[model samples]
Target: MTDRRGVVAKRAEDLVSGVPYVRGWNRARRSAGALADQLVLLGLDSDFPGLLADVNVFGDGLVHLGTIGPEAAELLANLIAAGLEAEQHDTATEASSAMRREAPAA
Candidate 1:
C-alpha cells in the first residue's frame, strides 16, 4: 500500500530545503512553536528520525533550523499519531487477516 504519511513527510522535508534563514527559520520561539504545531497537525513530526537523517544527509541542518525551545516539546502527539495511522485499514477483517498471515505458525 502507498504510504501517504511517508510521502507527505518526505515532501515536507524536500520543501523545507527551499525555506531560508533570517526570515524562514530564524524567527522568535513562539513562531517556531507554531510551525511545529502545524507540523504536528500534519502528523509529520513522527518522521523525525528519517527527517533528521535526511537533513544531516544534505548537510544543511544548521541552515534549515535555528533553535528549538521547550515550547515545541509536545512531540507525543506525533508518536501516538504514527501508531493510530499505521493501524488504520480498510476493515477489521483485513487487519486481522494481515496479522494472521504475519503470525508465527504453532
Candidate 2:
C-alpha cells in the first residue's frame, strides 16, 4: 500500500509540474488565433503574409518570458502598465469629446 501511494504521489507531482507549460501553451494558442482573426478582419492578410507567424513568435516569447527571470517579468509588467495608461487616456479623450458635443453652445 505504501509503495502504491508513493507511485501515485510521484505521478501527481509530475502532472503539477507541467501545469505552467500547459497554461502557457493554451495562452499562446489563443493569442495566435486572435491575431489571425484580426489580421483577416483588417484585410491585412495579403499585405502582411507573415504577420501571423511573427505574432506566433511573439506569443512564444511571452510564454517563455516569465521563466526567463525577474527582469523579463518586470518588462512585461511595464508593458501592461503602459497599455492601461494609454487606454485610460483614450477613454478620457473620448468622454471629453462627447461632453463637448453635448454641451449647449454658449
Listed in order, each prediction's TM-score against the native is: 0.22, 0.44
Compared with the true structure, all predictions reach lDDT values of 0.44, 0.48
How many clashing pairs per prediction, in order? 0, 0
lDDT of 2 by residue, 1-106 (tens): 3243232122222233324544444665677667557546855334334332111211221211112345544654675799899999999999999999999999
The number of the candidate with the highest TM-score is 2
On the 0 to 100 scale, the lDDT of residue 41 in model 1 is 84
TM-score of 2: 0.44
| Tens digits of lDDT, candidate 1, 23-60 | 42233334545645666787755443222212221222
User: lDDT (0-100) at residue 65 of candidate 2?
Assistant: 17
Q: TM-score of the candidate numbered 1?
A: 0.22
- Quote the lDDT for 30 in model 1: 47
Candidate 2 overall lDDT versus native: 0.48
- Report residue 11 deviation for candidate 2 (angstroms): 12
Cα deviation at 38, candidate 2, in Å, is 14
